[model samples]
Target chain A: MAEIPAALLLLADARLPAGGHAHSGGLEPAVAAHAVTDLADLRDFLHGRLATTGLTGAALAAAACAYAAAYAPDADIPPSGDGSAGGRRGWRGLDAEADARTPSPAQRRASRAQGRSLARAARATWSHPGLDALAAEVRAPHHPLVLGAAAAAAGGTPRQAAAVAAYGAAAGPASAAVRLLGLDPLDVHRVLADLAARMDEVADEAAAAAAGGWDALPAPSAPLLDLLAEAHVRAGLRLFES
Target chain B: MGAHHDHDPHEAAPPAGRALRLGIGGPVGSGKTALTAALCRALRDEYALAVVTNDIYTTEDADFLRRAAVLPDDRITAVRTGCCPHTAIRDDISANLDAVEDLQARHGRLDLVLVESGGDNLTALFSRGLADLQIFVLDAAGGDDVPRKGGPGVAQADLLVINKTDLAPLAGSDVARMERDALRVRGGKPVALTSLRERPDAPEVAAWVRGALRRARGAAAAAP
Candidate 1:
């Protein structure tokens, strides 16, 4: 096992101002449908989400991290930070992969919106050539790809990027549960604590999956989550972006 | 409104070659939407204007602006606050920034962008990174004591507007006391009192906005 990279904490921190706060990770629509009314229901929903979209997100992040780690220019690069054409093509392909994995158009929009915000925050914070190239190639790259590139920028491994992605997959919804359902914050956090080991396991699987090549990356789609996201868009009242 | 410009020397100058972003924030039902509409109607002829509304639940404010036809649909954008209105404007301003930039992208260059915040409590404020200037609106009906409370919004905002003055007598609120208390805590900042129903144009506030826009343009022109 490798030591944890200190920068992983910053990448995963909710306070990074990357527009993650506005997103509920499908928790809002779940609560609206009465699918998750309490901590127990929320626990089931989180576990289910972790098993599906969480795993897929982690795999995507791992792949993106691996790509950035391999291709990103070092700090000594010129001020222009000209990324190779191959790097830009790689980023665009990964972005298309992310879009393909996201079945729902609404979910795709939410992912891109967050991705754009994360790109701005990452470029400003890390000043990495890979992040700049990704931004240039895909105006709105998916969130997990930016997360992976940010991990690479922060000197983290693919496993670390997967872990951060996996954690956000559950944590974003858990926090939203507290606000939307008015659940006990402590109890909601306890739910996250119980699932911490599961998230790590998913991250481990994701890192292993990334090594299998981009075409072999996991594509675990949550049909119900897709429905919820679509419904969330046309819903009369909505607090979260997704 | 008066000519009392309280420019903080430490405040970062507004970014060059963009609309001067003005934020309007206050408690629920304090007439933020109304003021935004008024400002749009007042200034749209003179300047290229756009709006970004942080409506709590849905695009109510943006919809209202559209229905009122203050500006074209392309000029107005809505940003959901994810249940924490203050966080979108003050803590993590990315969503609002994205909305503003989207508007700019759609319409080339804009002279003004009004980012109306979802109704929040007195402590709510626009991050300096988001709003070049902020106006905290308080209704006379909420309570005259609200100004005396003087939280960050009331005390530190660039301009404070005591709105719904016409309802003061009906609501048994003292407009005089509200103004006095606001001025006391504002440290020489200007305050305006208005009734949107009577003066739909919000002439005094519009005049203040014109002056602020002029100064903002002058400053942006002066910047490197």
Candidate 2:
């Protein structure tokens, strides 16, 4: 019965101009490897991604939300328009923890790249100190951290941040599959629709784990996805950054 | 929850002491890259220069610049556009920004940095966030009516270049008509008519860029 922020839709909207459109979320490489060729293959790919990176990202976002909201009440200071994030120091450790969780250099770069872009968008969209703090503390906090901070700024709870993370984890790839493989838009939306319940379950797990601190956040890894990302960098042709 | 900010077109100044970023964008096969290379060759001797190219598929544009040896192997950085070259340059410019900043960091204090968009359509215009100024290139061979059918790239870009004028007579394209139409749509903004085949050095475009760089640096100095 918890309320979702009206602005959460904006944050999760693909049209928000966070530069996520230029990334296929590793689906391009999976397609290159012929691991995802048909609707069924894509569904399986989505399931695997939702279980792995999706779960990890949701936990990180939930943890970031918990961290930010906990600090928000006391930091009633005005926003820093000069791109400063004041009074929020807990984000850096979470960023480092994200670094440790991601072993592949390519994935780290991708995450940092997405993080930096998200920071710019979130700062411009929301006036919360958490965003400026995150921006100042972690010049490039992982994408989910910015998402979580943005969620908090939008007055959403940890569960909603987890949900946004879970949605992005699957949504970005589903959209990319349409572009890269020329798959039917309806079928891909159906695939995402079918995963809704499972997505909710994962988000709940992430939110439940929120109060346990950064170390306690979920740490799911997809080895094949990482390998595919590494391979995608040297790939002869690509439409996505990772 | 948006920030209370000015709606000024050039809001965020280029990173302190960073190179002036000039975007080159136009339709596929419009000679955007050719002009970029030509400008590079013409201006590299006078200024510390670099290029960031957005490619929809592969690194062909960057590769071409490298093959031509216009600046150097390292000065050219290629960014993937996820098949939407317009989004990378205009709506969501983070990737292109990263590429440009990376090049500027690697080679410090560049006088000019050209961010060339992947060959895109007339709707593709570089965001002011990415480029300090933008140049939209159109081939006269594209048709004399292209400027008449003005889009954002044709109208809003800081400079417009109607290139490939040598083929105008052969292609039956009236350069004078296109020039007149471009001037009308652009509200007296600067427009150049170029034939890269004859002027491979892109001297006129180079002069425009040099003036922009001087003004950008002056504005930065003029800033508080």
Candidate 3:
């Protein structure tokens, strides 16, 4: 039998207890308001989310990991004392773009929360100097940044990192939907399985975007999700954050 | 999976030694923030205390505590969960953990870290990984039936608190029945009836926390 890479296993373990279950990815309000009602609607919602927010987020995370891996040899990325790394100019730009693309304040906060959580978990489980340095550079690490650092620290390829990020983005909301809409667990599993089957394609897109370099990153454009996210923020009776 | 197996040897060591983490959760307008403030006032002089508050869109809870001067601003950190309060405390606790570690790193010796979840549904409860003990607070304004409804917070929290007992009569809530249902659902896991305005000290609740901390310290000392 072939030896399983512990990094992959660790990243894939749903039970690692990273706290990914509470977020519905704005699907709660979408479902509550009847914007997403059935399987077909769910598929569309997932597709839209994957193409826009999911695609952008996965690419960013992959790129962040690639940057961390590429720059690992240079321990001066944060620039001692001055706190400015000439080599990190591209990464700074990418982080800014991510911030701008995430229009909803709630979504941005959620992403940061998840990012910091991933960073803490990685720090506790795998204390890589490079990862720690990156976390320190950004006082509030974003999710993709942490995922990228973790992936690199664990020696997982950029593709694998993107795949994990995509899976988590889709699976988290789908699981929430199962509880929110009272859908069957088996049916939710089916949705996740179907989503999982497309992991390679999503990973490829993310990988390609990352390879293109941060300067040539894609533009952000997911208006409906943003609107739903905004609406969710105003809806006082909401159960999910966006 | 390939990822988990590959990194097994590179994993970092567990936290050296730490005090018990306590989580405070409850519904909206349930006096969770007030309870946190009161606890700080009551425990700060005796035990080194740090607090983490989760707010959906702002740092209102942390701001409130800081403004109240319960502890220095550095002793408290706020997590903007963005969506569900449950996600910050239960689903994903990285932010919360970082806040706790930051406090401990700066203070050097913390006896307790209190995590207050943003106002949420009764289903919300802290994950064991995030908190050693959990407190669930509900108010008379939510009605007496809330306890009987038996959500995870009421059924599973290590300690349940029904706040605003003073408002029960005005709101037509039965504080006695609420207490009865809470004990019934919790199977004897201690419930405290508190009126933050009337009894900010809440000696009984404070004693419970003290006892829990003592037991936690003993267990940690015993660990190999």
Give model 1's TM-score for chain A to 2 decimal places. 0.93
Which stretches in model 1 have alpha-carbon errors above 4 Å?
A73-88, B2-13
Q: How many Å off is the CA of B34 in candidate 2?
A: 1.2
Model 1, A91-166: lDDT tens digits are 8878877887899999999999999999888888887767777888889899999999999999999999999999
Model 2: how far is A124 from its true place, Å?
2.6
Which predicted model would earn the best DockQ?
1
RMSD of each: 3.1, 6.3, 9.5
Better by lDDT, candidate 3 or 2: 2
Sort all candidates by DockQ, best to worst.
1, 2, 3
* Candidate 1, position A162, lDDT: 98
Model 3: how far is B171 from its true place, Å?
19
Instruction: Fill in the DockQ of model 2.
Output: 0.64
On lDDT, who's better, 1 or 3?
1
TM-score of model 3's chain A: 0.86
For DockQ, candidate 1 versus 2, the one ahead is: 1
Residue B86 lDDT (model 3): 82
Evaluated on the second chain alone, the candidates' TM-scores are: 0.95, 0.92, 0.90
Full-model lDDT for every candidate: 0.89, 0.84, 0.75
DockQ of each candidate, alpha-carbon based: 0.85, 0.64, 0.21
Give me the candidate number with maximum TM-score: 1
lDDT digits (tens) for residues B31-139 of candidate 3: 9999999889888898989999988756778889999999998999976563657877877676677678888899997889999999999899887878877889999
Model 1, residue A56: C-alpha shift (Å): 0.6
